[model samples]
Target: MDGAVIGLIGTVVGAVSGVLGTLITIRLGGAEQRRTQNDQSERQGRSSAYSALVTACSRTYRVGYAAHATLQAEGHQQSPNDAETLEEFRSAVEEALEAVSVVKLHGPNGIACAADNLASAMSGWRSEVELLADGRGDDQRASEAIELYEELEDRFIALGRETLSGVPARP
Candidate 1:
């Protein structure tokens, strides 16, 4: 073979290899960017869900505490017109449930479970309060409900913190 022909073949081979390498690098970089964007979007979604759940839980707790305090002050007396207060409590519970639904959709399984447990505890406490007002429940039961609700709330908060901490800080 001629020396010039051999050189021409070598140059063509080098150029093809360079082009393939560039194409592969670009494809891989695009994939990496997509993965990064997906991670960021997921983190943001979880963070927003966590915030919403926490806020709803806090509001529910406040309303429950107020109702419980009022009952305590009344010494569990039978009031003929407690409908308004009951309705307010129910509204707060509904809000919490809605927020927890969001958490279940956006958060990890563990966090979702924790939020569910907390909501259940809150509901139990509410029922216990109703029973107390009707003079059908004992102080012991109400106290137990309160303790369970508090413990679940603490667990939920801890789970939220763990979930948030695992998320990387945004630039």
Candidate 2:
């Protein structure tokens, strides 16, 4: 209980407390850094998925529009390349549908819903084109279908932008 002994005990306690604090700080900092990195990675994945969906949808729309226009102009004539065009349009739609799957996997529900809407729009357009080829639809109907698809596509793009930019979706 001499002054030197008391001082030594006090110094030891202080050193132990300082080490524990440093360890705790380091652990917490590491956890925070890891959490941030994970968030960033998830965002990147979602961005990629959204971009892919957009690209796929665009391609499908273009192919479908072209096919529909050709069918309207040719009046059901079985041109040699008509088969090829049909195949291309089908492939594009399949790709877009697959991209929608990717978006769903990386989704926050809102973007996924938008993606689904776009996909449905594309399918509707494709159906209109099929009806056109079958003489069940006219040019005006094809045009309307395209318009609907474009509107849905714009919605999807807007939602993707908001999601990627960290803006919350409006309810």
Candidate 3:
């Protein structure tokens, strides 16, 4: 081939190679960006769900403690407002249950387990409060239930913090 024809062929090949390289780079960069955004969104969701679960647990614990205190003060007698108090406690428990489900959905397994433990502890505390109000339980039982619930709640909080900080969950 003549020099001009050879030079033309070389230029065309070089141009095609540059275009392909640019296209591939753009495509890979876009994919990486999308992956990063998805990771960030999921992290935010988990954070919000964990926070809600903790708040619900706190409310339930407070209500249970109050009910226990009221029963203690009245010598286990069912007061006129005992029904109302029990109803309020039940509502708090229900809210906590819903929050647990959310945490389970957004969980890395370990956090879900912690949330489940806390919910169970809260339920047990409620049962103790009921027994005390009905004169079937003593102060010690109520106190023990409260202590267990508090411990489980603390565990959940710690696990949630670790999970949010990108730590792998402990079995």
Best by TM-score, which number? 3
Going through the candidates in the order shown, the clash numbers are 0, 0, 0
Estimate, for each residue in 40-143, the C-alpha lDDT of model 3 and write its tens digit.
99999999999999898878878877887898884456777998898899899999999999999998899899998988888888888888777788789888
- Better model by TM-score: candidate 2 vs candidate 3: 3
- The per-model lDDT (C-alpha) reads 0.82, 0.86, 0.89
Model 1 is weakest, by summed lDDT over 10 consecutive residues, at: 74-83
Clashing pairs in 3: none
lDDT of 2 at 111: 83
lDDT of 3 at 108: 88
| Model 2 C-alpha lDDT per residue in residues 19-99, reported as the tens digit of each score | 999999999999999999999999999999988888888789788878987998843675768778878988999999999
Of 2 and 3, the candidate ranking higher by lDDT: 3
- Candidate 3 deviates by what RMSD? 2.3
True-structure lDDT of candidate 3 = 0.89
Better of 1 and 2 by TM-score: 2
Instruction: Work out the TM-score per prediction.
Output: 0.88, 0.90, 0.91
TM value for model 1 = 0.88
Error of 2 at 66 (Å): 0.9
Predicted candidate 2, C-alpha RMSD: 2.2
